[model samples]
Target: MKFALQAKDILRNYANILYLLIGITTGCVIGFLFGNQVESIKFIGDIFLNLLFTAIIPLVFFTIASSIANLQSSERLGKLFAIVAAVFLTTVIISAAVMMLVMLAFPIAQDDTLRNMAAQAALDNPVSSNSNTSATGLAQVLTVNDFSELMARKNMLALILFSLLVGFATLRAGEKGKAFATFLNSANEVMKQLLAIIMKIAPLGLGAYFAYQVGVFGPQLIGVYAHPLALYYITCAAYFFIFFSLYAYFSAGKQGVTVFWKNNLTPSMTAIGTCSSIATIPANLLGAEKMMVPAYIRNIVIPLGAPIHKDGSSMSSIIKLAVLFAMFGKDFSAPEMLFAIFGITVLVSIVAGGIPNGGYIGEVFAITAFGFPMEQALPVAMVIGTLVDPIATLLNANGDLIASMMVTRIAEGKHWLNSRLPS
Candidate 1:
């Protein structure tokens, strides 16, 4: 019985890592061996991403509504929101600073050769050139002309606001509200279970997706754009370890840092492989549980943070901005440029949920916010977003758990980690 239990524990702990390794190995082998023929298996990746996308809307709506409804009092909800918001804002500011410094240290220079290659690539794969005409201003983002528009993935900010309204209304509706909240809670569980089932096949899905991407793009692109891509990967790793570790330590002390990294291993790997923070929420919640955070805190913070608190997106946006500025021969050190980068990245990060490949959507904001040439700048930004998205998602997904821990510590006012540790 003991050996069986130990074996089960090991498998459970290492499942995500095993899957990631298998997927990467399979992708490399298939991509190298079959070349463009690997595109035939692209459907496997599409199905996986589609499955993840299908769950994101309901998961966000139900989880947020249910979490707020369960708060049971306006005061508790207010306090939770305040703490979460403060932590999120602080992290965003830190991420922005880190990104700025990294960009300054390793500036991407424009190369005509690379630009020509990118142009060729864009020509080979003709993407829709339609611009996002939706309201990106603060007022428009917060306002909905039609409530139905909130259902669209692109209107994530409006969707979250609508969910909050529904949650609050459910709280005020007496017994009817209670029943509805209960339904939402049940629905949230169902969505989670659905995610768990989808994750079981992640190896096959991620493998096919990566194989297709590599086969289509080939190693030539990586070689052409190695500097910025490598720099982005290295910077994200530093932020994950240095900034995140320090945040955890301050929140819950040495033991807090220990528990956080120990429990986050699988979730971090899962994020890298799947490249979707929404898909990794379940694993993050499990990590929070392992760190001894209360269920209420995990339920509230993880879901809400997944969409709103995007440290990774902020970092990636900075990278995109840096790349675009260099490619267009604009000075990134200008005060206005710095302010615009900070403001737009923070705003866009909040609404990054709902849209498929939403990371690329930031390019639209860059057009309006910084007046970059849409024709030249947008394509380069899109390519950069695609290449660095997996790492960005990994950062976003891991930061969600870390931020949850910080919020838990603040809300509970007691060291949640202390009691769980050995003497």
Candidate 2:
């Protein structure tokens, strides 16, 4: 009992720092020392990776469908979706712009040596001797491909579409949808419970995964990713402050940003630690309540927003793509970049939302979307995963904040909507 309490306290208190530090340290150390012998450790990492996605299909369908079913009307749902979509679209565009600016400001010569080294390391590191039982290595997991393949692969993004469709159908089904809604409701609740249980083991899972990685790889990653990573982090922070602050101010009005931060910090922290937005939903709702977001919006937007509208993820995707482009000896022309910003980022954000490790998934999607070779994806993903997650968490959390406020403003019958629309 005492041990359990102590463990709980540790998780409740220092879990994020502990998770990050231990992961980096352990992964570097283990990757360096054992290099490939940490089969058990690698297995533990694999389990956590798979664990993230295990409940996703049911959870997404239930959460989205039930939320839609509870809506006052489909018209309201449409209006809300329209607003959310517009906001998300704008966010993605701004994100791409910011990333492009940052990439231009601080262009790092592509380190092919680091990329090759990381890839070779991934291929050579036999973390588990039981190859048959091993899940695909992170390298393989991050491999880039064509956008067509990405769309066709039924990856996470595809699953999200199916979930949304299921949700919309459930809402449109009238009384007959009750049974399905009930089932979905039950499924969502069950998944939440399962996730709660999984979170208890999170510290352990995180510690082992990072330890094994560092243990295998050494501390070189810090240096290798230094400049580009720094640029990514700084740009994301700037976007959070300049853009999201404005969003909060406009949506919520005076004291809006404060309220937004208050409601979102816990979830943001949770996301940073877990690197899983889906996992942060419970905390996000609690936070939204603290912000006094209305039920109509909170129920409708937050859950829906969690999956489909990822402003932060979109930012990371654009930046990573630019990084890859720079790395691959290609200067992003005006047209190519415009296409990347408008065409790729928007579509990829919607598609990559379903992937487990969604933040990294976005980066991988960027690589594939732009027709990059598969080998480049993993190295870039590792760098982005470490560099981008905290910012993404902050942005994602703030997006929830912004969305809550936008919904609140709309619910109160404010003139905010008119400002964005035609007179």
Candidate 3:
């Protein structure tokens, strides 16, 4: 009887997600039949993306600033960031470890074609190194020269840092800043609702976009790249189903797993369809809320994690290393090599996740670290990154929602979910 109630509740409460699923599935079928001919319809998805992108600037600013400013106790703010950082770093390592094991067990791909390509690539491009004296490049990544630059989506790390500073300032104001805090909180609510409204068209927008993706990239999933693509998608799917369930169970026991999977579908689909972690923030926020995670935690984790907490990238970074190592005939089975790959993947997934051109940054770093030919290694890894993006984004985006559960259990006690449940 309880199971029946839960089933009915999911169907009733999550009906819109079902519609989205149906729409995307239908779109994929349509795309398969028409192939590249659907290019004309891309404008539909473009419009939705533009609206979302424009709205996101205000949404992120308001959510983070308000969450910080409106935090009732300053200590909670400290705990939140502390717990978040720990969770993010821990999960990144876990993800990398899981993928490394899989890669070691089953090498990505070893082919003469890849080797020949690598040789040609080495001849084509010269290797370059960083100038030791310069911290300028690092500074630019975390902040922008002009305040106006923060308004752009490309400068997300800068924007997040700026938002944190604003929130912290308002918080430190105490009672004297009550009015501004209220205003920030109010703005956050309004922006959240606006994002919700924008997402109402997710079915149409995401469906159309998914169609385009299928029509364009579907054919590339064959020949040389086919095996590597299969490995990634399959590994990601297994991790998504298995590890996420384990995390959810750890967070709140059996009930947490139930609540999590019920609410996870929308965020996962949104990530898959959009292939952008930033775009899936709202869905993740809503998903966390539905699971009864505290708003303060979700508000902070979802926005920040969307940019940085990349379980998916952690896995993919390892794959990139594996592919490069294979291409170069390196002893990937060596413990020393895996140790180096482990450290690099962790850095690439967590640190580069927030920076622009993170893919390029990660790929180039992997190439240089292994002394792989940059010319050949870079392009091959780039291709793999593109191929795995959708699934990777699925893991990266949804990981935040589940992380909120972990934080809640730790911060609010193990009985947290029980209180949120009906008596």
> Best candidate per lDDT, number?
3
For all candidates in order, the CA lDDT equals 0.72, 0.61, 0.74
Tens digit of per-residue lDDT, candidate 2, span 1-423: 997975675476445545555665656666667756764676665566456445544554455556556555535556777776676677667777778777777766656544555454346444311221222454333332544432332243443455567777877887998788788878767766775665555445555665555555555655656777778788887887788778777776656777776656677777765556677778878887777676667776778777777777777776666666665556764565677456777766665565443433445445544445433344455446555766676676557657777766755655443344335
lDDT of 3 by residue, 1-423 (tens): 997976675466446556666766676676777998887776777676667657757876886788778666734458778988998888888988888888778875657655654564444343321211122465765688889977754455567679889999998989888899999989978886786787677668766765765676463323456676777788889999999999999899999999999988899877776667888898998899999999888888889788779999999888777777777777777876767787778767864564332354456555554556443455456556756776888899889889999988888988899999989
Q: Number of clashes in every candidate structure?
A: 0, 21, 0
TM-score of each: 0.60, 0.60, 0.61
Arrange candidates by TM-score, descending.
Answer: 3, 1, 2
> Model 3 — TM-score against the truth?
0.61
lDDT ranking of the models: 3, 1, 2
RMSD of each: 8.0, 8.7, 10.4
TM-score, structure 1 vs. true: 0.60
State model 1's lDDT.
0.72
